[model samples]
Structures are given as structure tokens and as C-alpha cells.
Target: MTIQVGDRLPEAKLQRIRDGVEVVDTPTLFEGKRVVLFAVPGAFTPTCSERHLPGFVEHFDEFRDKGVEVLCMSVNDPFVMKAWGESQHVPDGLMMLADGNGDFSRALGLEMDASGYGMGKRSKRFSLYAEDGVVKQLNVEAPGEFRVSSAEHILSQLP
Candidate 1:
């Protein structure tokens, strides 16, 4: 089932490039923290690279000032995610995470088949606000659309 408001995020492990690919569990990452977790279909894709990720990087401080940690996830390896973050000049605080196997995406019911685009199984473009591990809001963009999941939109929806 798709995760909904009031639903606690499923337990899973995610990878980030810090300290040579550190692995973090969902509970530890979200525990007692207000977070904006946004997923892109794949790293380095046109819209994801040019707009989606950049929006979060630009507005990262706004979210931090509000005590929200911004996380960017993609169905790519940690190396690609790290390179993309570096290419985009992503700020220190915004996290670049990898759901390489789409396990986390599948667990959230946000995995989508992108084989038609030569990208196998991937994550849908979406953003969710979670506090202390429970979801408070979700914005999922339609296929080939980029509106609701943008940082400006997610920032505006903060409680």
C-alpha cells in the first residue's frame, strides 16, 4: 500500500557517500527529526538534475531554519548520487541518499517501472514531510510532470 499521512515510514537501509558510503537505517535517520524526503526517478536525469535537486539545494537553508532536514533520494548508486550532489554544488546540510535497489521506494509503494525509458525500476518523483518517523504530508508528481514535488511547493506546505 502507498504510504499515507499519519503512516510511519517503513524500516529500511539507505546509503550516502559520506565517510565512504555510510549506511543508515530509517528509524535512526527520522527519529525525532522533522524531515523533507524527496525522491527522484534517477540521478542525472534532465528534470531531476536541472530543477528538482537544485530547488532543494537553493531552499535548503529555509528548511533548515525551520529545523527540517532535506533529503534527496534517487534509484541510483551512492557514487552517482554523490557526483550529482557535487555537480549541483549541493550544500553541506542537504543529504544525498541512494535507494540503489529501489528497496526503500518499493517499501513506500513509490517505485515505478521506468524500463520504457531504459531506466529499469525507479522511484516516482515525490516528496513527503515526516516528523518523528510519521508522515504528515505527501506530494507526488504525475509522470513527466514537475509541479507538486518542487522544493518551493514543499516548503510552502510546511506546518
Candidate 2:
């Protein structure tokens, strides 16, 4: 089922380039934190690289000032995610996560099929705010749309 407001995030493992591709768990990351986790179909893609990730990178301190952790996820390997973060000049506190097999995305029922573009399974363009592991807000964009889920939009919706 699609995760919704008030629903606890599912248990899943995600990879991050921390000292060499460390595996992180959902509970460990969100158990006692206010987190904003955003997903893109693929890392380094047009809108994702140009607008989406940059928005977060640019306003990262604003979110941290409010005591919220920011995470960026994509359906690519850890290496790609690491490279993208480096190329984008992402700040240290902003995490770049790799859902390599789309396992976490599938668990949340947010996985999208991108075979037409030869990308295989990917996560839809979306963002969610969670506190103590329970979703507080979710902003999922419609296919090929970017109306919501931007860093600015999510910042405006913070509790």
C-alpha cells in the first residue's frame, strides 16, 4: 500500500556513500528525527539534476536550522549517487541515498516503471516529511509533472 500521512515507514535498507557505501536502515535514520526524504526517478537526469537536487542543496541550511534532516534518494547505485552529489556540490549534511534495486521505493508503493526510457524500475518524483518514522506529509508529483515536491514547497509545508 502507498504510505500516507500518519503511516510508519516500512523497514528497508538503503545505501549511502559513507566511508564506502554503508547500508542504512529506515528505522535507524528516522527513529527519532524529523526528516525530509525526497525521491527522483533517476539521479543526474534533467529535472532531477538541474532543479530538484539543486533546490535542496541551495536551501540545505534552512532545513537544518529548523532541525530537520534532508535526504535525497534515487533508483541508482551508490556510486552514481555519490558521483551526482559530488558533481552537484551537495553539502555534507544532505545525504544522497541509493535505492539501487528500488526495494525501498517498492516497499512504499512508489516505484515507477521507466522501461520506456530504458531505466527499468525507478521511484516516482516525490517527497515526504516524517517525524519519528511516521509520515507527516507527502507530496507526490504526477507523471512528468513538477508542480510540487520541491525543496521550497516542502519548506513551506513544514510543521
lDDT of 1 by residue, 1-159 (tens): 899999999999999988898999999889899999999998989999999999998889899999999999999999999999999999998999999999999999999999998999999999999999999999998999999999999999998
Total clashing pairs in model 1: 0
Tens-place lDDT per residue, model 2, 1-159, is 888999999999999987897999999989999999999999989999999999999999999999999999999999999999999999998999999999999999999999999999999999999999999999999999986999999999997
Q: After superposition, how far is residue 117 of candidate 2 from its true place, in Å?
A: 0.7
Error of 1 at 50 (Å): 0.9
Q: Which ten residues in a row have the lowest lDDT in candidate 2?
A: 14-23
TM-score list, all predictions: 0.99, 0.99
Count clashing residue pairs per candidate.
Answer: 0, 0
| Model 2, residue pairs in steric clash | none
